[model samples]
Target: MWSRSDAPRIMIVRLSAIGDSILTLPVLNALRDHFPHARLSWLIADYCAPIVRGHESLDELVEVNRGWLKSPRTIKQVRRRLHDMRLDVTIDVQGLAKSALPAWLSGAKRRIGFSRADREGREFSTWLNNELVHPSALHVVDRNLGLLKPLGIDNPTVRFDVPEHPSEIKAASDFIESRTLRQGFVVLNINAAWLSKRWTMERFAQVAKYLADRYGLASVLPWGNEREREDAERVAAKVPSHAMVLPKFSLTQLGSLFRRARLFVGSDTGPLHLASAVGTRCIGLYGRAVDRSGVYGPQGIVICHNHTSSDDAMRRNKDNDAMRLISVDEVCQAC
Candidate 1:
């Protein structure tokens, strides 16, 4: 437990995944609000740091390359950097060995982390963190907020102050203007990081056609890789006049784009959560039951019907059978 220092030094550790990192924004902002004079830092990997890079509440952005814990040189640098910061508290929001390493290395007394059940690394991260929190909240976002209980903040006003750079905002504006999406368009993120979460491109095309015909809204499909691009092209082929396949967009540009979007249709990926964070209505198609991990806000409409809710192990499986269960008519009805 922190001894109630006025200018407490804190470092929040959530190292990977665009979706989880976006969800952690509310934690950052709430911490900043409560401890106004505190020097707040976030430990994140370089790959996903772009998502929360320029957040107003963050005092420092401690970045590490992938697999930094294995590299002696990188470990030394991180140790030195964190040692200099003199973090009073370390919050391991990401409950894994890799995320726990920073807290263990930081030398902070109050290394807050989730309980054994919530955490993936029961043997490693559990012992590294001294302050244990057993989260009772249903949603992952609220479960994260529950960690703030040890800090005297309960029921904090949830906020995701997703930073939008001027250049990226301008770029998003230019693209929307050029595409003539001012009349209103729906962002169709047809790709999912996990294969199990992905729906068929043909089904996606049907939803795109419905949006165009029923609401007169265009569909913009964004892709991350070549395979996804090819899949997007196939979806676009069906609704040529209504759907437009977008070229590669940077993470920041996508954030800006979601802010101007009317609705977002995708699986439970980063883009869906990002769109939801930016106040865009999202129709999130889930492979598992609609549990706490579904889109955070009321604006999100999730479509899912599984025997049980999803966990980390279930989410990583190589089966699209659950995804196939979601019909195009279900998505169209949600639209």
Candidate 2:
């Protein structure tokens, strides 16, 4: 292990989904808090780089294109980059093969990672690290913070401040102006990457209509892909004309839109997590996954339930079914 006085250059690896990446920001913040003088860099998937770009706590953001990693030319590029930087402490927060390889190849004097028993990475990957942190059953936020335990850094209440951009502010303003939604609006994201996790289109329509009729709040539906756009349109068809569909937005633009929204409602997806991260009042729907490990909801009205049968619950654990059984009325009531 390197001495704290060595002033080591640190590299953190967490090439995961957007929400997972966002959830890791607190760890990054805490690392910065503990080692105020360390030159910190991050290795993240290409898609997630934008979220942390220009972050004040991070000294540099390295983009790892997964598609390129599959090619020899790309591997050479990555090797060259790592070779040139020569990190001192490489922390693998993703705890997976994809994230492990980069940290292992970085030639860092000391590497730290979560243990396989923690379900963060495979057993062999632990061998690549100089230090292995076997995490206990805790929230993912805390699990990530546990990596710093060996370094004598124990701050747990780290906060994430997502950077704001002028372009995004303009985009959000343009969207609001073009739509003429002058009154305060509720932003509802109706899409998820997985089909099993998405609520039915009819269910979304019912929720949107209820929010409009009962609350007199205009609903804005933001969709990413074609299928999601179709779903958004279907939901919009059932609500008032003032309830409109938003076009695809970049990460910064989405952040801007989220900031302007009074409340947000959506599935347990990246955008939903994005809303929560931005401190929006969020009501999330989760039917196929566990929210305790990754999803965050603000105080007062975050709704989650389980719908699985006894056998399925036994297989997945009743605690994992927190979001599966939440009904429309339950969520609406929470809202």
Candidate 3:
């Protein structure tokens, strides 16, 4: 029912989680392609905004601090800001009470979201949207794109237009130059946000050592926080000859690193998704998400323990038996 002559003020709402935010990039791409003349805005968390801050396809960004919901005063501030935007259409790809509440408050004429059966917090959020879409069994990227059907967008392409910051690229270049790292060095990320998803430090060392000895490749370990830095240091200590632990970097700097790397080896996490988006070949280790099926891009491969059952894969803990069952040789061979 929408026409090319109409220019609706559009707002997309997908907030938090590094990986999920990156996956929502395709939805932005589709809307940009179809409604080039419209004013398109993204309501994202403050932390993940840098990933797409300078993207060419985006018109505006609304950053919501993580703790804003805790204070009534701040909540009113956010509500007032969103209401002032006068959005004609609002798409809630996040599909939660937190996201739904804001979408509802925006007072958009065409509010779209996943159906009650397809989305979580169904009982709480079912009434927030004027239009509901029943999604198919597809990758989260495509599932997010499905929300565009009501706006007359279909069969959209998967594209990640992650912007490059010149300063960040210079930092990445300087780091590589200082280390004397050659082209085609592998990036090994040792931490996952979830405890059940991390492969052991010893196994990571073994893989790094093997890559060094067999393929003459150096391995760099990039950590996000103090705990990850400690783990990366332990791994680097074992293979001191070929492994280097990187200092903490911003999101854009990590993207710069991934763009220069020959390949990426990591658990199912935000960095792995970032690597795939930047056109790096990736070997993702899996436990509960073993059959990551369509989640990866063309050059990305997933390795998992053959014996793990589907129902038992996603348990939460520091030491996952299924993840531990995967051998270093399996990961090395896949790389």
Candidate 4:
């Protein structure tokens, strides 16, 4: 273990995937409490950096844009950039080569990361870390906090200070008002990164119809891409009540909408996790490909399909039988 200093410079590496990035919140909070006066920095990918960009607990955010380090010249540039930080300790929560390489290059004296058994690696990232953390079967958030144990932060508390935006909140409020929707609106996200996790549009329409008829709730379907927008449109067309397809909004605006929503229903995706982070009630529709362990919060009501032994098929997004097992009534009952 590294000896404690008055103001040790620390860097945390977690890159990509909105859900994984959000799960790293507790780690950041725990580090803040353990070393209140220490200089804390985070190395993150450009895409998902917006969520934690202007965070109050962070001293700096080192952004790595897409395809920056594919070439040897760029890799050296990245190495030189991190070397300039003079990081004393580097904690890598993302157990991947892409994440580990940068942390190793940061010139940190104590490079702490996951054990080899924790995750797969082609880049042999585990060899780079001076310290290894054996992971438990805990939720991803708890597991992230576990990385702090080596740094003398034993009792890591879970805290996610989601950066607030009043302007975005107002914009969300205005958009909802324009749709003549008060607070009791259910935001439906009908998309996922994998096809296996995405529920049928027919099922989403039925759920929307049921919620509208039973609870007098309007449904707002938010889409990220053209395919999702098309799916949202299809669901809206089929629903019997106030279901509308929402235009694209920034991540901050989406957070504001989730905060105002009475309920959030979606497949196992980033928005479902985002809604949970913002203290919104969410029913996460998950498939067998999704890891239900440690991902859901207390406010999240997860309804996952039974386990299947088709990992290969699920990876190819060829098997959606797991998602099919979740009935519309089951989702309504949870809501």
Candidate 5:
């Protein structure tokens, strides 16, 4: 962050959620490029740590669970660790009250964060960061990179160093052989963290059939929980010739599988971003969220049906009629 000879201690504070965690990888890559000698670290949530766990760019990965601040013992432990790091700067990429508190706790002289114009960077975060950046880009990845202008870095090369472990590779290969999916397949991630973002099974079935008949690509459905598992099975049962379901696996393993798939068709969810990060062909389905949060690269094809909905109206936790607007014919044509 200073002289070429100096190796500044920098930490990135991104609290939680899967998709956002994947998007932050580009910022980490940029920072590493700018300061080759810098000791770079990331403060991530426990759930999302695996996404960036073994990245070549990161020197440290400090993971904490939700509501850790509420516990006096946990706070003491985290603060002690932050103090020992002797951080030169802490960037608040999360831009929330929870994310802001970590930056304040870091006690870094050059605490950088986004301006209030960014919806996420409101009054609470503004009070914490010592330096504020007014981002010019619309995409979240570009916006995160905009924070690096203070360090004399601009328009840095966009890259995601998603780890491909040996064990995960073997697991993915074994699954592929077991399922007889050697003829190449496309991932249909029908489940989403937001109900509003999830397209109907019938629509997914139609897309699955089209992929099978038109492209000779079978559909692979991956689920997170038991409820999703049942839904995936139901879809597979209906489209037995075209669709199949993947068993329980970790995020890392899923990345390995996605790397081998012909295409990824999913809503604005973690799996879609993960697929994008691993350099897979992604057809991102958007409704509640904007296309700006779509897949990161040229290989991505965004099918957005959102017309008049506002960000405040399409909350992730609530169900909306927006996703239904994305018809089967539209997805088939995109395919």
Candidate 6:
């Protein structure tokens, strides 16, 4: 294992989940700041690989197909790829068994990972690593950055620069043109991965309509999975005639679309975080979750609530205790 004195080829292993991957960019930047000329590569999931494809700080991006972990041929291919890369230091930022295998197989002299107490997963992943990054009372973004401390890198100002795809820029421009939207527009992303976290479709529709009537702002909705699309459609049905429901877009395309938006309002989801990363004003709806560690607002107003247990049972009660308590008036005031 290379000591702190030696600058070695490094690989950062942070796989899937778009929001989490976006948060890792600061860590990548810190590593570059510490080792300006060191060979640095990122092992990212195929789904989010496009977001960091042309990152200036990275030497190379190694794609890891999470689906392939279950297949022997895919594992063999990944193993061969790691063998060819000859990484000197492997850091497992995902802290999951799935992320650990790549680090173990990378044949790096120094394998670093979160300790068992800090991370939840198969314990063996930590056993395989040569070093452990102990847990501290830090944000996930800072924790990811802390992993670089072993390599002599310290806390650095977070900066995420996602490139704009030419095609996506054209598409967003065409979308605005098709709608005859001349002024600034607001992009409202209403869908989230968890059902517990999402507000009612009717509620989102009401918000969209309110924006159109009061703000005179054009609104667009972006959906990820099929269920999210259905939710968007439901919201679109109730929106003003001018508000549009946009089609699915790649991560890069989404970044481009977000950059052009005047405001972003969404559930605790990836695209919301992406918008926040780009310094867009955001109003995030968080339920049954902590906003401090995650779902934080980005240099803008944020309204967070924890849904009461009554809200969880589908009882249709308006308790207004936690997240459900966040009123439409509060959200509009932020916007």
lDDT of 6 by residue, 80-153 (tens): 98879889889898887888888998899888888876443344777778788785644677777777767766
Q: For residue 241, what is the lDDT in candidate 4? A: 63
- In terms of lDDT, which candidate is stronger, 3 or 5? 5
Give lDDT per model, in order.
Answer: 0.88, 0.76, 0.83, 0.81, 0.88, 0.76
lDDT of 5 by residue, 146-238 (tens): 999998889999999899899999999999999888989999999986777888998898889999999988999999999999999999988
- Clashing pairs in model 4, backbone N/Cα/C closer than 3 A: 139-294
lDDT (Cα) of model 3: 0.83
* Reference-based TM-score of each model: 0.96, 0.89, 0.94, 0.93, 0.96, 0.88
lDDT of 3 by residue, 1-335 (tens): 76766678899898877888888888898998888788889898899898879888888899989987798998888889889999999999888777888888888888898887533335556688888888774567878888999989998877897888889889889988988885569999999877778889999999999999988899999998899999999999999998999988998899999999988999878898899888899998877644422346788888876434343224554466767888988888887
Question: In model 2, how large is the Cα lDDT of residue 209?
Answer: 74
Tens-digit lDDT string for candidate 2 (1-335): 44455456888898878888888888888877777788889999888988899888999888977686789888888878987897888888888777878888888878899887735657467878878898874567778888988878875576878878888889999988887766778888877765445666666677777777788778899987788788888888877564688888887789889888888888767777777778888877766435344356443244545533232225333342344455777766766
Off by over 4 Å in 3: 118-123, 290-295, 306-314, 317-319
Clashing pairs in 6: 305-322, 305-323, 306-322, 306-323, 307-323
Clashing pairs in 2: 305-322, 305-323, 305-324, 305-325, 305-326, 306-324, 306-325, 307-324, 307-325
lDDT-best of 1 and 2: 1
Clash totals for all candidate models: 0, 9, 1, 1, 0, 5
Please give, for residues 167-209, the per-residue lDDT of candidate 1 as tens digits: 9999988999999889999999999878888999888888898
The C-alpha RMSD of each candidate to the native structure, in angstroms, is 1.6, 3.6, 2.2, 2.2, 1.4, 4.0
Pick by TM-score: 1 or 2, better one: 1
Error of 6 at 320 (Å): 13
Off by over 4 Å in 2: 1-6, 307-324
